[model samples]
Target: MRVDDFCDYDNSFPDEFYACLPRECPDCGAPMEMSEALTQLHCSNPKCPSKVVQRMVAMAADLGVKDLGEARATKLVSEFGLDNPLLLFSYEPDKDGVPEGMSFDVANGIVSQLNAKRRMTLAEYVKLAHLPFIQTSSQALFGGYDTLDEAYAALEEGGLGYVCRKLDISADSDVSVRAARVYETLKMFKSDLYQCIDFVEIIKMHSAEMVHLTAVCSDEVGFPFKTKADFYATVNNLYQNLHVEFLGALTRNCDYLVWAGADGSPARLTNKVKKARAYNEKYEEHKASGTLKEGEHEIKIVSAKQFLYILEQLVK
Candidate 1:
């Protein structure tokens, strides 16, 4: 049976199966067996550390991002009828095997109607957006605003407006930035980065189990240090492997790349000069051999801070 198929028959598992509250390990992405008797989950990997350091890292990562008190986030999540993390928000697939519709916005609206005073976290918003919905319209998942951060702040402040105001742009503009960030963030986790384009446009995944972060204008460009050649070489390969036409289109229209997938280290754009040099040499040889036609093919490194500035400019 397919690994994911087990999720469908989870109910078939005896009460003992769930009594312990077992889960997957965040670090190694391995299944963990929980022991209520021990009050902890154990990773089967004998050498795997308990991921203790990650806890502090996770907390630090959430420094400015979370506003809703743990109590409020928890309460709001429960009140919004999102008891199950998996049901927080989900996307229905279209005939093309892409996400067809989402009920997250409707869920957000419901949460607002239920409790106007409470705010939601990005994780909560993700959960709500993933909630199953039978709606006929609304293709995007995790609705209510364009961006996850905005939606999160709104959830905390009892509105999306405060987040919009922080962005210093019209609500719709902030929304666009949010959408772009979510797409980019998800892409970082998947094998096929471009597929994230369609995933953002179609499937509505939520952020509970992932890290959600965005760089703001407070970020100054750090000192420009030349990166190691190894990194740039990888970038060159990534650029070459990608469809240049697509990159050109993305470079022109894209802005802030808000990420919400795996969160540990912040995403970075390192320029590997040596790798780039090698790539150019290869291109020259390929052209001489009639393998690669002369063309301007390159990759764009959109840093988190740069991403935010780009979007701010776009909105303005």
Candidate 2:
């Protein structure tokens, strides 16, 4: 007989099976709440030991620290009485005793790995924080800010109402409720969980897609363009197929400096222009001294006409 034929026609299972399952979380003894769909049971306690261990393992992986699997995380938590995953960053080999099964060297290696990842992008920090209902899509809420301080200041000043306004979400919408939860969770985490590590740097995230080259246009008017917006539209339209990205500022990664102003003219010597030229000079000096690393290239300074010509040839 086929297995399907042997099974009951109805999907219902025996009531005994449901009774066999525990109604409470095994580790934390918290009541387990059944989902609305009745497909899964969720422990209501956020501080449940099992959940904490899982979070510890996940946070370690997300932070790029290797070898911090579930078993190791459990051992660390039990040994150190760790209440929060972020506390792992504070573990000191000199001050703390090694876990029963782990050697001092292994523990030290884990600390070293964690320390090496002190510099993280803002997006990475947000993901690691694991704020409630906040995912990658929420990153757009932080657009236009180049530093965490600026973003945090705005959030503090405006609160969840600010986030809803920025996201164009109605206050009574389901998404607004989620945004409120995320805001409250972020505030809670910032005070305790986020203070666990002394960060070396928190780089601002860029929302643009990756491109082979990035160019910055001078705001000063010059040939073939009357305004900055006109320059942007013309060049960007012509070079859309050239894998080149444009930005308003001359960051370190910029590959081209497009300026239509006359050479050495006051209008041409803006801070961006001067910075790009200085960078090129430093890059050349490094190249001549045999200290330049591979893949390092100087920013090419070009006028609008020259840039358009270069892009035209490149597309061909």
Candidate 3:
């Protein structure tokens, strides 16, 4: 009953499930898209230098902004003792490595600063996008402002600055880095959810192993199992004895109900139906006794696929 024995295992990579940038940029008020070549970064700006600077400043502010509104001048002056801010701007256009008229040291230093902060806030990101290098499209990378309104609203509300200020406070004192950790934790949560869905889909492909399929609606939910047509086809074809029931009484009575399978067999389908009826009765009794909350209870409904996994794991 090992997972591999019953299920044909597929090693779908994690990147397949991860979220990507939305269709537009959130800065400089332009559309953002990938290039067909995928070798270089493309920007909404037709002018190349502004695109370059936008990209670099985005990179620079990857973690957070060290200094807002100030050009890389102060950092360069303090660290490298550059007498003239213009001295840092020399570059060669033809060279693919570092573009002409851009400060590599400054870019590198900004990158370091960003990494040190370990997170980026929306305000810092906007500030970075508005840098002189980005505006001029110098030797830097480009940034896009796809959702201009939403991004701008976040900036105006000071949410972005609050996040950065909190991070700065954490660096200075014993404050928790919760603001910084929020982004990383959400990403991990999404990764885990993807993995769970992948497991459920893999269980469905095993037609012989599927015993019972039931649909108990809490809300009309759709899943990524190919398409609506494909999902219905898989369920109907694999589990021909599929049962569809409306929890008319239970939905009106309880917050949630457990959709339990009986003896791990679709042939014993009457038992599951009976169990569902009894569950509603017991739930009502508990509700009358004031043990269950009127509006807050978790209902556990089983998918035919999920039930199969549960049965397999129990047998092992």
- TM-score list, all predictions: 0.23, 0.55, 0.20
Candidate topping TM-score: 2
| Model number with the top lDDT | 2
The per-prediction tally of clashing pairs is 17, 0, 24
The candidate, 1 or 2, that scores higher on TM-score is 2
**Predicted candidate 1 versus true structure: per-residue lDDT over 69-139, tens digit per residue:** 33333433334433232221232222212212323554344333222212232232333232122111112
Candidates by lDDT, descending order: 2, 3, 1
Q: How far is 141's C-alpha from truth in model 2 (Å)?
A: 4.8
lDDT values, one for every candidate = 0.32, 0.66, 0.35
User: Order of all candidates by TM-score, from best down to worst?
Assistant: 2, 1, 3
> Positional deviation of 63 in candidate 2, in angstroms?
3.1
Candidate 3 lDDT, 162-281, residue by residue in tens: 444533444444343444343333232333222222211112212354343224432222333322222332333232323122233444333222232322423234333554566667
Q: How does model 2 fare in lDDT?
A: 0.66
TM-score of 3: 0.20
Per-residue lDDT of candidate 2, residues 1-316 (tens digit): 2122223232477856555656678877777766555566667676667767887887776555667899998999888777677677678877987889998888998888666665544544565655446554345555545466676788899998887787677788787876687677667666544465354344333435312357887776367665554454344334323344457689768878887653443464778888888888889999999888676788888877777777777767
Number of the candidate with higher lDDT, 1 or 3: 3
**Candidate 3 local Cα displacement, residue 220, angstroms:** 20
